[model samples]
Target chain A: MNRKKLLSGVLAVCIAAATALTSAACAKKNNKDSGGDTAEVKKLFVDLHTLMPSASENATPDQPHPVNASRYIAAAYKSLTGTEIVWASDYAKPTDNINNISAWFNQQINIKNCPAIGFTFGTKMQADGLYADLGEYLERPNPYVAGNTRWKDIFEDWVWDDPAVTDANGKIVSVPIVLHPGSATAIYYNKDMFAENGMTVPTTWNEFIKTIDDGKKVPGIKYPYVPYTGDTGISLSSWAFRYSLSPGFAAHMADRTDYDKNGIVSTNELIRAVLEGAFNPNVCQEAKALYRLAYNYYKTVLPGGWESITDTTYLNAWDEGKVAMKNQGLWYYTNEKSDVIRKFDFDLFAPPVAQSDSSAYASDLPRKKLSEGYRSQVLISFNVMLPAVSGNEKLLEKAIDFLMYLSAPEAVTAMVQENGAGLPAVKGAEYPSVYDDSAWLDREFTEIGISEWPLGFIEGNTANINAAFSDWVFGEKTEAEFFTIVNREQVNGARTMVNNMKINTAGWNI
Target chain B: MKDGKKRKIQIKYIIAAALVSVFSLFYLFDFLWAKTYKVEVVSVSDENPVASNGERVEIAVRVTHFGKPANGHVIFALPSDGRMLAFTTLTDENGVATLTYIPYTANAFLPVHDVEIRIRDQSNSIFWEINAYTDLELKMRAR
Candidate 1:
């Protein structure tokens, strides 16, 4: 009986000891998880890219006035969360090599030290599982925001529905913080030069061409229309021309090309459409007319050495009053207004619409209107994303909290006011007063129903597209020859994309 | 002998239960009661008295809380436009955070202009404002 009592006592002691040890272990873990007593402030690495000021510019205060929008954001976030943001050193310099950034991010991911927040151009990284699935978190109320039911409620429904921010599985992978009315491209004309030439802003394609023709006769104007073609990717002019004119050519093909029926044609869907014989730029009359009309317009307005001039050269020429009109993004309006040394006044107008009389393929679609409330072509900017490879759930939670703070209406207003890049994506966030004089804000935008860039189908195909277009423009390749080369390349690119993505071809009917 | 052994066993059980209770209380205390401080900004001043447009001027801000310097607190220097002039910096041991600022030329005709220097805390809940005059013509000649 004594032995039995001793055994029971021993068992009770063991159970109690185990329970105590478990509680102690959990307490230690909870402390570390909450970072309750840690003296060191946690750090989250980020790459805000062009959305932030260059470190070199900001580091050396003697340089040109630097904008510290991202710094303010970081400071605000740290104040709230006690987490410091370490920006990537090379965040300001733009690189055409998307792979380099992707590779660096992947390497960081492997080492488990990936940046918590960064920008991405497309959903490729999201598909590779590099970006965290933000759908569930977005559905939950943002803790930092007061009276917010869902985090996604901060953004407009159109922005949240954009496929660019969502993956193939319809999971939200990125947060777009800025939206601009119409496409980013606009025609910036010299106000003085326009008045001197007695030409008003063109409302139709014919009128636009005529205005350019008239501007060419002006003595000092070296190039009447200077469209930036320096980028190895699609040039500003090329993108504008193709997208603006696409509706006239391919509006009828939307039913077949827009596989998901989202109104916007995705790159994958465009490839599939080409493979399935739904859109053949070479054979289809409307498609053929698109390239021909776009090419002809370029030939008319562009100078002889237009292909050789870089964006800097074109911008310098415009500033020097040598270029009468320049095609640029809406963000340039802020830049031009802020230039202290700028001597000439400038104004912007939307790309003129193509009337039915301009071509048989023209759809006679009324020019799309632009307003603070009605944004037709919503350009998603600053797509901030979280790295999925960061296995620390606590760190992820902190990063998400920082993001929530950034997406708040007040924070977004501050960001927009500092960056002066685009309109705020979050509701209740006010845009800068600089946009008060923006004529394009109330004018009609060049309507684009189906966006198509046929010259380059794959990543490295830009060179071929540029070359072919250059040769064709320089009278080296006939229109037919240009179409043939581009058509074959398009098919190969579609095939490559299909193979790489392992895209299901079950219902493609290809 | 058995009764004595049972009493000893009962004593062991009480000790074990006491230890568990102590541990549980400790865990709860650590989880529920952690220290947090309310930080605030104290003052802002221009370190350089004479400055010109396009020349880097040093702006310093002092931050403190409850009669003590708030070390490692982040502060920002901004222009009248409310855009930050430089990246944020943490307060040093003296509770002073300094940043470099270059005044921009608003107009060539009006060479001298007043620049409003706004200092903000990490939360931007409090602000301290100061002003400095910059000569654009002098800066232009120096350049």
Candidate 2:
């Protein structure tokens, strides 16, 4: 009886295997008969990062939905090609740590079930050969876009040179979908609170400080000013403060550091300048004055326990009338409007300039008018990339096709409107009326384009740099102690970057 | 013959005892580890009754579980009107989550709007499948 049972089990296994093979063959034959394009590329898995809504939301037009750009873009793609988008539900959630998401994508790419299309915050993945080079494809015409000869022609010229989308080898590894034309960061203040204090929008650093001091006197306000103390890296508040002040102090270093003679300063050039002793944060009086001014301003306005506040907490405080003013990216305008329960009236203003009265280091240069040269710290938004790990040629082609469709003017406008963030990167796309404020148009005076400078060195050391600055500002460490720690870290960070990128620094007479 | 029969009986008893131990472990694991959690929406209130278009109206919600406040949970609030955007916020230590809503277009008169609120875990998974609602009046034009 045991022998017979074993034989039957073996026979069943053999029959199952045969049936699977036959079914696969039949399906392939049927696909060929029906024009196999659809069969080969039935679905594409995508992770649009923060641009798309959460899959768990199950958002639809029938209900009050957050702008579901992924759904809208998917529908348009489906109409153009008979393919479906399987939104990568398990990857790149808005709340997930960006570093973790990038690491997860790197690991997932080795598996068979990796997403065909995804996004990365930096170009490290492209450097690792994880993303497909789109240089050739960009030269091809986008069929969906009317009168477009080349796909790359649709975007702003600066986008091609932006280090975020392009790799060091000059390969286009990612597509730029959005651009921040003017000031990316601003102060969102409570209009009612300002009115009660008889305060008007401040254009100079002294006026801004006075507004904060006055707002502190109000009975209901717990924190008169809350600069976003969230992530240790370049945050909304810190970036705004650094760039707005750095121009007045560090603008003189621009001509010496911009090695390539390009209008903008690249990471390598800044690193080289640091090594050559052209710019030193440890001893330079201008640099010291910049930090001193910033420290004093933050020390005066920031409330106790401010160091513990994240973006969410600060925004919550602002919504609850606990905060009178908070620094945030322009994206918060649409974000605030979408809130169904926000009770206070609020408006945005540019970060006030540090005038000569505030500091001797401050330049008397006029604020730069709206121009293409003065771009946001985040040069590009919605950085879509095609991962090479998917390995299927047909699937990758379909992914690229869908990206082309998204790049068209109509689709780009829809996405920008839904995102409520930066302006459109593509020309001919309609500018969202929500970002029409004139305050965002005029740039800061002596606005040095290298906003991240010494503070934003190699990615690994940025957190330490930010922490040391926070410690000094919050009274945990003295100014001298803070400078000692940051100076060493910044030099080491620049050296590490130089070595990793194999930058040729022999020309520099260090 | 008696010894052989005794050995067989001993083997059968060993097998039965092992099976019983495994079953008990399974039962204990279920009872001690997988306890079910309950979430309740205590209240949803409108902070502003006389809000207008382009002006913000505050919406607040309090969540609890078995009479204890739930902290750090996420709440997604959506207005009944499909044109306006939905908002999400986190409940504080006191189990309260508040967000500000503003209408884009103005109306001639004040209109009552109902907001649908859903509570979820920090990872964004729905905890209470059922949604709660609150109503408020907005003038739809600046006063």
Candidate 3:
């Protein structure tokens, strides 16, 4: 009887001890205060490290227009948690945009005090696994939202899952903040000139050229459309190409091509096709047509001295009302209202490239109307990257919280309103109804304008095409000569891309 | 003979104690392992933080899990009067929900009004916005 009593006493004691131990372990695992965790809440001090492209002539003489979202983001976390944010902009000046590699990876990645969140065009940091894989966090519900919605549900469909942010293994490595998919290749015209000239907005290609021809006689304006060709051969080619690469014409490749089939033919796929022996530039029907279109623009449509007019020259001329219209990108509107000379109102329209005569459709060029939004390429720029660092989990969490806050509908609306640029990547964002006395760009942009260079195509494609177009447009090369130059460049560009991709040598033609 | 009988009784006691102890351990496991949750809710919108009475203010409320979305039901105890518009709504998959409320009977920029919005099980005041003309509105309510 004594033995039994002693055993019972021992069992009860063991039970009590085990219960106590389990409770301690659970307490440690739970992210709650629970009486024992008395460590006072640590205030977060996060720095936003990023770079802004140096303005050509300074968009603002005394103060830069607010382009960074960090200012609005400053309020979001403060309202919720105890966080002190430092906006550390342009940390690496020299390497800010060194051919797409930013200062964040060039110098800041190694420093212990590097900004918590950074803006970069992908670098060794991302490709070499030095950046955090944001795949998990992007999926979690955003705390900034006052409802039970996951973060994954908030982003626009195409941008949230864009292939550009993913690595070779399909792991999402970054977050895309801005997707400028609309027409960068738009005609920002002097709306006052067009209005006074009694000219209606031209919906057809033939009508557009008529206005260009008519502008020469419109009292003050000398050139109706002055594309920025200057001494830069690349600029001329780009100017001509934007009007040439319509969606109807863009699908034709130099070699057989395979796009993402996500309905977006991004630059990454173009480069991949070039390297993988899936695309070749030499015999591409689209390339030939695009070249012809550029040649035609220089021959008939471009203003004289287009060979000499740098973009700045035309922009200055536009302010003085000397130039009536110019083919530029969406970036022109992002500048401050004070930057312009303010002689006339400005409006934007897509590049008009089709032949007026239905009979002139002898080539693979599109026979469709010019106003249709057929884009040749989709431009997805300015993604936010989170670098991989050790032992700063709390700070990292806070930075992510800020990013999520920026992705909200209200935040996106503010960004579009303040920055006056950048198509919001968040769904349900509001684009300002009007821009500078003119309406906003077409929601369904008319032309998927071609880029200046065949961006991310065969390696030598950019240089070779630029030279060919320069000689052709400058009256230095004959039609035969231009064709000869282009063919040679196409061959060389493909070979360069092959070497860059490091394909093993075989029976393949170089 | 007495000692042998005592020994048998002791064995029975030990067996009974062991069974009772094992059952107690199981009970402890169940108590600690079962899931339990309490939502933390807050206002997330910085835009239109202040609104006039009778002016519909879209109140955004979020139930969070440690600053992230907490997936669960959040029932709200609405103000009894018609002033509490859209008193019940569920957070979406991202822990975000928006409801429009008419806090006053008429629209005009008036004095500030403090409204304490609550989630039924203790937590409240998830969102606070202005109700101008509060005194006049209160007079109408009193009548």
Q: What is the interface RMSD of each candidate, in Å?
A: 14.3, 9.3, 21.5
Listed per candidate, the RMSD to the true structure in angstroms reads 21.3, 12.2, 26.2
lDDT of 3 by residue, B9-116 (tens): 999999999998887776655443221223433442322334322234445555554455644333343332223333344556776555444332211111233443
lDDT of 3 by residue, A206-288 (tens): 56768778887788886677763322443333534544433334543422333446544444444444445443334554555
DockQ, every prediction: 0.02, 0.09, 0.01
Residue B93 lDDT (model 1): 90
Q: What C-alpha lDDT, on a 0 to 100 scale, does residue B130 get in candidate 2? A: 30
Model 2 lDDT tens row, A1-510: 699999999999999989767645543432232223344676666666666654544444243446555576786576667787766554333335545766666555433335666666546444345567788889999998878899999987766666667654455777888766466567778888788778788777777788778877878887788764442332323654655656655554567767777665665566777777655657676667877777765665556556666767766777787788877777666566555446778877777766575777665435565463544434443333444324355666777887888778767766665565677788777554445433455544334444234554555566677778877876788988977776777778767766665667778765
**What is the DockQ score, from 0 to 1, of model 2?**
0.09
TM-score (all chains, Cα) for each model: 0.65, 0.64, 0.54
User: What would the TM-score be for candidate 1 when compared with the true structure?
Assistant: 0.65
Candidate order by lDDT, highest to lowest?
2, 1, 3
Ranking by TM-score: 1, 2, 3
Categorize the docking of model 3. incorrect
TM-score (0 to 1) for chain B of model 1: 0.45
lDDT of 1 by residue, B22-97 (tens): 8777655543321122333333344332333324455566665555666765554545422233445666897776
